[model samples]
Target: MKIGIFGGSFDPIHNGHINLALSVIDMLTLNKLIIIPASSPPHKEISGLASKNDRFNMCSIVANCYDGMEVSCMEIKRGGKSYTIDTLKEIRSVYKDDEIYLILGSDMFFSIKDFKCSSEIFKMCTLCVVPRRAQETDCIREYASFLRNIGASVVVLDIAPIEISSTQVRERLKSNRDISKFLPGNVEQYIREKRLYGLGGEYLIKEYKSILSKLLDKNRYSHSIKVSEKAIYLAKKYGVDVRKAELAGLLHDITKQMPDKEHLIMFEKYNIKLSDIELKNKKLWHAISGALYIKNILKIDDEDIMNSVRYHTTGRENMSELEKIIFVADFISDDRVFNGVETIREIAEDNLDKAVAKGASITIVHLLEKNKLIDHNTLSAYNRYTSNFI
Candidate 1:
């Protein structure tokens, strides 16, 4: 039987890690792949690392998502420096008759000379190294050849480059950016629910979205999800904080289905006083009301996030990038089949201001045709766009 060993800190496993594991297993035709989470990594510092149990559990969660994949607490259970030499020795002893292959990324392979009993590692298992994109084959082959001269069996696997790094995932999570696309849905939900990465409260996205769905009709809930997706797209395009964009888009219409009386009651309870024009225009009530509810009831006090929700409807002058992202996302959401939507979407990809201006123009035209009131902010946004972007 052929067994593969893939080990890492796996602080929180992401999709790229999962994909790489799958690729290696398929290429090597290994009967079983063991994923080991390190208790302590000797090469680099894990300053804000999660607990060993959390890392082990996360690896288990990810490994369980696939067949032929299993989690091993060998490093964590051993309770020391998490040396691979020791782990491999233990693994070899357990599966004495099995052919063993040790898998790692090219970066890790380059550092093998420093590992304790480095030569002993090769005697125990063949080394399979996955190269990073832009890592030249000549360089990899040269190093692999050098290892061969030293009695080490080094095989470089030409796996597809998944341009994701654990460092990038951690940084995005720390900066309040949405990692939904980078992580499995269940794992994302787990991280959010556990309040990992300092994202506390209703920041627990999936549960909050579920609660919102119950409060909304199917169509509206679908729209909210689409808007959230589009918001994230624009956020990435513009380098805005995606987490804030998603939250603003998701909750932008929380108060949309409510009657005027309900908005009034919420406003009164929150002690929120609106302008005469805002009070007269019932359509604009939801934005301010939603902002109030998010901060007061949900206890999310991020000023930028609240502002994004507050201005998604009418859109204030000099809005934040996140506000611009949500406004444009909500306007150009996938469910919106209005004329010029395709045009606005194309423009929004490279020119956000021009797209928002086009959206504002469309909203203004519809209001005029119905002889409904238009907010000054909407007019200002249109003027701003036409003057600067047209």
Candidate 2:
């Protein structure tokens, strides 16, 4: 059997960590990838670190999403500073007949010589180094050659550099910055739910509201708050995840006020290609840009929430429960006082599907009356939900 060991101080596992792990497992073709979270890293200062259990739980949350990936509390259970040689020795004993591969991030690879029992660590397992930056590839390869000369096996993987760091993630969380793009949705949610990283006393909604207030004008901010409340009510009625619904609603219009140039710049930065219709429709820019902002900057890695934000303005076919809540919430939020709003609100209370159909029909008719272009997603939604009408 081929086994891989990936140990780290996964104080809150982020996308960078996940990307590296997946890369290693795929490249190495390992039978299993054991994720060991360090209880106490010997070489680094352990300031503001999360509790052992919280770290372990966060790692477990991410590991569960991938096959052949498992989290071990060995270092945590050992109750002291974690040493690589000791971990490798323990792992070797378990998989006596199996080949062992040890995965190391760029920092750890560069500083391996300073580690305890470094020579023994090299002999025990093949060292897999993933460079953190493109510029460091040559240096990393040179060092890997040095290791090979000293009878140590080394492999440098050609993976895109992992740009985010745990320290960066902590900094963002400390300042109430959005990290949805940096972390898995569940992991970020776990960090917020547990109030880790000095985020105590400030609830998730309050933090989001603070950030939203800065991004949006007073009217838009007020509308977001109302949408959040309405979404929560609808979530309760529909059995959707209330917090997710609230978050989706609160951030649905995050980039509504961004200028066309800014949105285009963001699209170029993130490599988001736009369809012909999407390029022409400036009104639809917010949903696309806002979802990207939520993912790439705010680092909210929840696809459902991102999609809810992306498609809220133009409802799509086969919308999720949370998506429906936000879509309808936008139409009937307290701030909305347009004609026929009361009827949609009444329809929403009894049947969400009907409310969505009614809402889409209203939007389509309104666009037709004004000779405005209808979004393809809106048309698709209308076709899907109003089949009986046809």
Candidate 1, 1-390: lDDT as tens digits: 889999988868888889889998899999999999987776656566567787787888888889999999988889778887998999988999998889978778988878899989989999998887755666888999999999999878888778787778877877778888788888777776667755553356766698788778999889999999999899989999888888888888887887789889998997888878788888899898888878887787898889888989888667788888988999889999988889988989879888878878888998899898888988988888778854
Q: lDDT of candidate 2 vs native?
A: 0.90
The per-model lDDT (C-alpha) reads: 0.84, 0.90
Evaluated against the true structure, the overall lDDT of model 1 is 0.84
**Which 10-residue window in model 1 sums to the lowest lDDT?**
195-204
> Which segments of candidate 1 are over 4 A away from where they belong?
43-47, 201-390
lDDT per residue (tens digit) for residues 1-390 in model 2: 889899988877889989988888898898899999998776667667789899999999988999999999988999789989988988988999898999988889998988898989888999998888988999999999998988789999999966998989998998988888889989988888888987753466788889999989999999998998999999999999988998999999999998899999999998999988788778889999999999998888899999999999899999998889999999999999999999999999999988889899999999899888888899998888888556
| Best-performing candidate as measured by lDDT | 2
Winning candidate number (TM-score): 1
How high is each candidate's TM-score? Answer: 0.54, 0.53
